[model samples]
Target: MSSPIRLYMSMSLDGYIAGPDDRPGQQLGRAGGRLFNWLDGRKSGGPSGQVYREAPATGTVISGWRTFKLAGRRQGDHHDGVPILVLTHYGDEGGDGDVPPGHARFVTDVEDCARQARAAAGDRPVMVQGAGAVRAVLRAGQIDEMEIHLIPVLLADGRRLFDHLGPDHIELDLVRRLEVRDVTHLRYRVRRPGEAA
Candidate 1:
């Protein structure tokens, strides 16, 4: 039993992960932070706090280069200083200007990145984020489970989480659902091919 690759993210009702024009200065884009308003760090002991704390337990993180920049290049401190594997087309030659040398390892292959992350994670789950990384993992059938913090508002324009999935249908089994504050937390287990329904 290898470590599971899990994706945890907040998305709007319309399936948008971030608002339109989600650039460096703007970060999550216009009013996109609303999706995460429910994650109140002040209430760390509460349910919202539990959700905030869950991310830190991850042993490794996988992200897209664009998302790494959008996140202000925090390295892996977001996951309590865990190793971060960045997926990029430029490979080692790129992302060094902002990410530094040892803070992150740049990899061109999505599957290989995930493999390294899993090995580093050991028994702990590997946290996957960034739209590009998530999409690539999905296309590769590498994701084991997912936790979606579904927001109430709808952002008509922005990056969608389920785009470019091709014609094949990806099935997921609902594991848990919780309505807390202004967001609904949904957990799902990805059903691999030939798996029981």
Candidate 2:
């Protein structure tokens, strides 16, 4: 069988996943989205942005409809190079996401999205992107691993990254915590239902 879904994202010290007022032109900046800089070290040849550049060259990258739309409208069609999956109630308009070098598809359900991604990814990796959308996968227990680039900055009030799904928690172990320049990159493995203590 294929591997479980993997969620990659970052968080702040205050717990605000994104900048609070998420209006157009007033996005994560004022809402404490500075945390993205943690992964900023990954510039063209730098460290922080390397995770994004070296992520196994997957078949597709999945995101929420909002994120996809926002990136599409704001960035003006630049969705990395892999195919993208946007989960939302809105229909796939094709113009809402980046013009991928691979492909792009809009999906509604999580399972169908994963199946399609697995097929497209082949032996490569599938990136479950966007902080808000990743919480859904985590809540559903569909995520198997995580690669979080822990930055130093903090947001006073941004988007909250948690799902508030009962009191249950996903167990994780530190696979690596490397300090790249001024930023820190952390890797973790989600513990299964009945693993070890």
Candidate 3:
């Protein structure tokens, strides 16, 4: 069986992932940097801090075009060695080459991208980043788990995490919750109707 797909992201207390007017240079938008203040001067080797120290053994990463372009333009291969599958209709664009050699590829279809990511992941889980891609996967019922790092900030005018989820209601079961400084980590298992609890 293929590995499951997991979506991970950090959002403000008010549920905004990125601030207003997000651009290439300012992907997180104005005042967005404040959301990551919990990691400043954070020491390693502590029990509560282990989650930050342990690198996720992700086999593949999936991201939306805007996220991929911004990250790749600013810092090449933001996910390090993990391969990334960028979902976009403009696959012929030139920015795709900014990623590490053979580390990233562009795909037009979301389902095909997920399938390829899962195959590439093998035993490990496929990591999906960015709010746009997360919403797409969630609407498709392709995500198995979601880990949200809730920061203690309120970006009232930024892009919401769940803005365009269509008319359907997606259900999630809370699996774990941990508090590290001002940030709260929430792990949820996606559940569909008629599925075993």
Candidate 4:
């Protein structure tokens, strides 16, 4: 069997992944970079810094069109050789031939994207980034694990991670929690609709 799909992302205390007015140059918006301060060794000690620096590379990355655009669409350097599958609408013009060879591909259907990602991942987990891709995979019941890095700052008005997940109730079982300075890393196992939390 292939490895499970994992949704891994960093968010603010208020559950926002990016601040308002996010754009090309300012991807995180005003002061939103604070959410990733720990990764740059600005807010943590040696141990935490090492943890961030020495983290294992993901096998595959799946992101939304907005994220792929915001990231500048570089080929090999973007995800350290890991293939990135971008999820976008079928008729959307932005999905055409933008990605470099051997780096990423455009995928329209959520389930097909997941299947391809799994196949590409082999024995490693497929990491899903961006709110749109994450929501799509989650709604499809394709995600098996969720690892959220919760930062200390809270952006009152921004794009929330779970803002528009419809009215469905998704349950998660807490698997692990670790405090790395000002950030809290939470790992959860996503449960099916009828499964107990």
Higher-lDDT candidate of 2 and 4: 4
Which pairs clash in the backbone of model 1?
none
Over the stretch 1-197, how does candidate 4's per-residue lDDT look in tens digits?
A: 67789888889999998888889899998777888876866345654554464335568888888887788765434457878888888433446544444677888899999999999888888889889989988988999999888898879977888877888988899997878677887889999888865
Mind giving the per-residue lDDT tens digits that candidate 1 earns over 1-197? 99899999999999999999999899898888888888764365765677767777898988888898788776445566788888888867556654434557778898898889899998999998999889998889999999999999988998898899777898999998877768887889999988888
Off by over 4 Å in 1: 41-46, 95-101
Give each model a TM-score: 0.93, 0.79, 0.87, 0.88
Identify the leading candidate in terms of lDDT: 1
Q: Candidate 3: where is the Cα deviation over 4 Å?
A: 41-43, 73-78, 92-101
Clashing pairs counted in every model: 0, 11, 0, 0
Please give the RMSD to the true structure for each candidate, in Å: 1.8, 3.7, 2.6, 2.5
> Can you rank all candidates by lDDT, best first?
1, 4, 3, 2
| Model 3 local distance difference test score | 0.77
lDDT of 3 by residue, 84-188 (tens): 887776664534544333567777778888899998888988888878888888887889998887988889988788888999777789998878677887889
- Candidate 4: pairs in clash: none
The TM-score of predicted model 1 comes to 0.93
- Runs of candidate 4 with Cα error greater than 4 angstroms are 42-55, 91-93, 96-102
State the TM-score for model 4.
0.88
- lDDT for model 1 comes to 0.84
Whole-model alpha-carbon lDDT for candidate 4: 0.80
